[model samples]
Target: MMTSAKREAAPANGRRLILFGAFDRHNFGDLLLARCAAAGARTDIVFTGLAARDLRKFGGFHTLALADAIAAFGSEDADFVHVGGELLTTTAWEAAVMLQSPSDTARIVALHDRSPDARTAWARSVLGTTRRIPYIVAQDDLPTRWRTHFRAVGGVAFDTLPGAERNEILRALRTATTLSVRDRTTFDALRHAGVDTDLLPDPAAATPALFGATIGQRGQGGEIAALRSRMRSWAAVQLAAEWGDDATLDRVAGSLLATSAASGTGIVLYRAGLAPWHDDLDTLRRLADRLGAQRPVAILESAHVLDIFALLAEACAYVGTSLHGWIVAHAFKVPARCLVRGPADKAARYTDTWCDVPRQWRTPEDGPLFPETISG
Candidate 1:
């Protein structure tokens, strides 16, 4: 039995939190940080610059316009506001420059999760966006090659943030020393930036997907078998020269639908949304006939980091081309088999975390873990 007086005092431990990013979906890291930060404080999530339906369910939150993300902090003085900005792109579009903290203000910035495809056709444009934010609150990291780009984004000659290393800083913030990242590229970048970035794995299998045991001890059923079966078929299809065409995706979906019907379980599908290009929700609708219901698969369009992770966690395994999907899936210990081209940033992180699960990067049949590492 607790007394009213003691219960009344319970509110003293939690801190009022203000999170950035679009929380339209479940993100493992995002949810973890927000939950940890609000341990004792009554947090107020300022969904600034975002219009996500996923976040609507979060009560006692005030969704501010993008224009208000910065100003929302001091104007609403609840507690400290962490700088949750997207590191890969410096554009002020996702940063809070207008809400610059006082000279001594302590801010936390989220770093990159994508690899440095230095050949990325979008570098110069990203640099231009950095000029808008003008300065960095806390420079989180990504892969090594991407650092130069981050420096360039801020339009500076590269004067790094002081004492912001990963192990030390995350501890100092009273938070985990690890920050969620999407891939090895981002991990390498954070290592370079002196930040310890953790890879957010792709969605886990809805069923038990234990991979720590020996070949005979490994649990193989449900989604796991489905994955193995698909790989065999997909491999031959690839050898025949049909990979990314719409027909292949449908063939894969058919397998999943048949499995769902046999199991009498509700089927759920998801998209990584990491790449802004092909995450059209309409694609899911197109496959409605072959799905259990209209929501058979959800091609997540826009979601905050936490929302995305949560959504992915529900799926048994992730079979997608999105890099983030692979990261979040594996991070949650979910089986995420990628259909990517080759040694990609996301593939690196997945391979590093759980070598037992074959990454099969573009390789037809599943073999031992892909040993190829990311390098210069």
Candidate 2:
């Protein structure tokens, strides 16, 4: 490990680095990405939609204005710019926002997502405007769509390794300045693609300070404190509306009630989605009302992500239709089991280590043995 003097001296003479990402939301997972970015930034301004009330949970930002930073871009003073660890499938507003004002001398760097399908067409278009790109978390044997996109964008080289099997992917890695990957799938893929693999964990996992702070704040007694403190073995439940299966929701509710009843602990249900698809609240409300007569259930209708996370921290275990709920529980070291209804790939990709249900936890003949699995 480097000495304190070396660490302190590292950024003393380097140019200011401007970091950017889709941090303008109330999602805890997104905040985890922002926290990772914050941990590395020497001096930075964050452009996030996170309310001032919740921004305090992740400290160390120089400026926390959403509008000014989004509007002005950068001050043309930084040496390099980096956007880390977010799926860029939507419109390229952020890339447009950041590149709008660029320092004449800044070298742009990016942390690429692991999946080939994660980046969208608009993202490729916006990133294409940059000079030769330097990639982070760069994968070998990228899907043709991404490979074509990178080639069109005048891509220079990759710095990080991810696995690939396609000769094209291996050929691409041969040009990377440095290389590493985080998953065995990627490792074998890259080895097949003919590139050396050095496994590393996802960048977001490296920053525990923010996650710790979130738990610390939750520990402080307040509006939810009474409920949080009263609950010791409650399990967290969350689901999305896009699934559109009322029967499934009912089953989940019944499972939660059974869990609560059997374990002798309250049940905390979270409405974890945001607008256009913020179906969790209404769905959870209906389920809570139905389960209330049978068992004590606490329905969290809060729109703030931290409040939900704080509540999750109090749970003994978590079972959820929302992937992030399981992730948050796992982050807190609480046992988590995912209730997957739709695509199993995403769940399989991320939750290989967690207890997971390839399908809904409950089936026609099943009482959803989830309570026993979760409480156990």
Candidate 3:
């Protein structure tokens, strides 16, 4: 565990650090990554994302636009840290759409879906970057005095990226003073492209060690408190909205029902991310409705990042599609099972690289089941 003194220590010679990532949105993992990076920093850190966003209400930082951040601090001698996430394969289109409000996402997506030229223009306009990979900044993007570091970032789908985009990412990574990836698949792909990177666990793995006390405090009140009081024991459940179809929900509900019956644990559904294309509260509510009040099922609709962490920290086990949720559960030594569409999923890749636990892959006949490792 890092002591407060160590964590609060200023950077050597008082150099500033620009912590950059896709944290401008409400995604749980991105916000958590920003928190982890900030907690571990030994310098004055400025959070930067694609757009200027004040997400503090959700326990995220007041992020400045990356372009604005560069203009404001680029001239200074600062260290640029690309805070860890699945940033490598994120296209400008995806990042642009995810950065929008949920209500506006559909309209923007629809307007640009059929027009490749319009989509490209809109993505570049929204992200304010012309780089093929907008999220991964190249050395030339910053001042000559600035140094770059890519820390524990993941790109499980990097191999599938277009040749031009892959080259663009490689060019940026080559200039990093320190580069590390979070999974073997990503590391292997980068190595195949002649970019050497250290393979480290996702930074979120250290969540419990760094913020367990804070998370515990958060659970003592509000929705977390009510849920804990209502159910003696519960499993934290989360899944992306894409899994909300009738057949899929039915399978998932059946599995949850069986697990609840067998272990006498209630179900607590939480949204891992509220950004466009992320988890949906309505999807979770639909799942709750399917559970049919037979077992104690509660939907945690809070968008505050710590609330999600608190829910996970207090749970006996976790079953979710969110890799960060599984990672946090593992950090707390709480048994967890990640639900994935297939073995190629990012969650599967991450767990395969760093975990001994088996992840559940969704099948037509059966949804994800509770890992047998979770004893009643």
Winner by lDDT between candidate 2 and candidate 1: 2
Q: Write model 1 residue lDDT over 1-376, tens digit each, in one string.
A: 1111111012123333344333222333233333333334444444432332334343113445433444444443232223221333333323332122222112312132143233122332432322322222222321111111111011111123233223333232222222344344554555555554444432232112331222123214434344334332111011011233466556655655554444333444443332222243445545444454522333333334333444444445555554445544555555555655455434444555545655434433233221122111
User: Whose TM-score is greatest here?
Assistant: 3
**TM-score for all models, in order of appearance:** 0.43, 0.60, 0.94
lDDT of 3 at 3: 16
Please list the residue runs of candidate 3 whose C-alpha ends up more than 4 Å from where it truly belongs after superposition.
Answer: 1-11, 40-43, 358-368
Residue-wise C-alpha lDDT for candidate 2, range 268-320, written one tens digit per residue: 77765443333446677776776866765677656465576677676777776
Clashes of 1: 46
Q: State which candidate has the highest lDDT.
A: 3
Backbone clash total, candidate 2:
6
- The CA lDDT of each predicted structure is 0.35, 0.46, 0.85
